[model samples]
Target: MTHAIPVPLPSALVDHHAIDLERKYSDGWGMKVDDVATTPSGEMYTVSKIHRHTYGVDDDEADPARAHFGYSLISKIAPDGTPLATAVSGQSDLARQDTTFGGPTTGLGEDLWWARGLCVLPDGALAATGADDHTHLLTPDLTAVTAHHGMPHWREDDGPRDPFASWISTTPAGRLLCTTGEYGLYNYGDLLDNILAITDEPLTPVSKPTLRALACLEADPVKHTEADLRPGVLFAGEPVGMAHRPRPSLTEQLAKLDPTSRPGDWYNARLGRPAVVREDLFVVPVFGHIYRSGNRGGPFAFVLVTDQGEFTGQLGGMDRYLDSPFTGHALEIAADPARERIYHLNRYGLFAWTGSGDLKQRLDLEDKRFKPLRHFTLLDCTPDGDLVLTHRTQHLLLRIPCPDTLDHVGHAVENALRAYAKERTDLKKQWKPVTWHWVDNTAPVHRL
Candidate 1:
């Protein structure tokens, strides 16, 4: 079915405001922010936190001396942009303290569970995944309820090393449908094989599959060709070495694999954590593949599966329409109950897909500053229809009223940045490597 193109909105619906939260809470860093639930009094609440270590790096020494403990910042923001009541987490006993890998520093607990992926249950209890390897249920007031670690079937040799993100959706029967992204730290062959299997079918009754495997697909590997091994002089501030190797084709690899075996069966034997989920349909952005189920729970299996060939075909069409290849990584998926539209953020831009997984509309925010150089890591839709997106170092909370709204905001932001740049000409010169912090390419940042 064909879908109508979405018109961009005007700039008036979009407002820009910054809170000097860092100044107020000097101990904490704002790592991620997510909208939880609206109160009966019409107040909006969000959960934010400061992570113990910088994203991506597993080592504690990689972070500066000041980065140790995690902190939680919960805020109730008023309609007029005022913070109602702010809550902090580090001073409490519920915080978990553990030493992370890669350094001698001790890691203090912030709200790591809340940041992974959170969903408010029908009973108003919050369900989230924790770094402690468990799922937590918390009250609306940010108090803990009960925690469940599931059955703990994870084996280190299985596949993924970390659980980057997780989501808990209640099934129609009230049981939880938990999905997690696998930590991306292993070999590509094992990682891809596991993800394809997980996306194909649900975990067995005896196995508890965490969502960490899915996150591995976002892993970016530096491909070096043989010529790159030779050192060469830099030209025009760019390295003059061998060209990078192109990513391998999944279609070609799949053709060589045994087709008779189930995707999971092959993955489970070699890879640790497969990207398997119990959902009716699953899509992996890293693999650029889509899998569907003909029926909900009856001998549920994969129907339509894509490989690099299909990925190239879809990208070819997208490039023709957008005048560039769709490079955006699909991070989060949100459903528009009103329009039945599935909105997701990718490396290229924000796109809306139909229920059948067909691309409907694309919001290209490819100006100079907002170019598709980095993938969008955080995405959420507000109750009032605003699309909030966060990138690396930059945060944008936009109200997408129409197509024009995106262009308006882009121009306004560019103009504002230009003015700021002019005022701080010396600011660019003062920049040093020490002033910059390395964040994982896949980590998300949001305001509380």
Candidate 2:
């Protein structure tokens, strides 16, 4: 017997033909696709937050009166965008009561919900970071979770800290590094965007045996609570005041969607909460390098880091000179190893660059060609070079087909930048930094 080779998928994605992923996998709840990652073989993995109730869900509700608690899920898809497997992480109380989620027997442990970060580890295991400062390692098959890495302290400073990791990536040498979202406070209320080394040493390249080893490892048991038996209260049993009335039921909200309703309107009506697109990091494939954005405070620039996790320099620090960090660019980057292409995503459009850092093409996704999808957050590239994107306001995954070749915009932008640089040099020659001396003339000044 012989195995048949699978036909290759199209290199570019079709805008109107995007996969309706959230509808099929959201399990009848509001969900926001947070982060996405792809395997070398083209498998797509997505992490999403599961909203249990309709709009207006609040955390101020009582314990048993659960309004909204953090819940999340992971889905694995084939190269062709077919759903293969799904693993959900949520509180035991909600999972048991809601048929949409798995119970205590589910593969993910407790408090593992609110997962916002995902990356394919060097060993091919999936590393998912969630609440309580933990990163859970699962088998490549998504069958069993092997390890729960509890981040107890900041690795760089070795200080007591708690950071919510929302972005994770791998280096070419097989090391896993993660960073939390920006605005993270460290010791003494200091804001530091700390990069965490998940693996103490570089991992061996992924092999079938190493992937299978994850399933064989023994995982810790999850402790269950007594709230498993009771259904969570979405509304207060007795009305206390006029201000705290129960919101409309899911069915009532669904009824508002008529045949003429636009999909965006329907989505907006049931919108729960928005998930922040955090700072992202990825390895530049063919070049075998790492590029990342600052976690929090910006002027955001992509910093180049070595495979061993040492800062080399800023890869896109020139943006600070050309564009204002305040209103200019909130750029997210994605790389295509198959074609050795790099992409920069910003508010206006997308810019494609070569592995050698030359502008290749520019795409404005806001154009009418990519209709109904606006405000795209650049995710990851599929193995076939399709750009994966998602609208923060919409619950759909959009893809734009990107072939190996693109219409060359030449070095016009580069030449223009050179002219800009020359003008800056002339301006700099006319100015210099000077120190100001101040003398206090007030009374009661003692000089030693």
Which candidate's TM-score is highest? 2
Candidate 2: pairs in clash: 12-401, 12-402, 13-401, 182-296
**lDDT of all predictions, in order shown?**
0.33, 0.40
lDDT per residue (tens digit) for residues 194-250 in model 1: 222221222221233322121122223234234222121122233222232112323
Per-model TM against the reference? 0.44, 0.50
What does candidate 2's lDDT look like per residue over 307-386, in tens digits? 33333332332343233222322345676655666666555445666554566665454555432223556676655666
Query: Which stretch of 10 consecutive residues in model 1 shows the poorest summed lDDT?
Result: 1-10
Clashes of each: 26, 4
Error of 2 at 431 (Å): 64
Cα-based lDDT at residue 443, candidate 2: 14
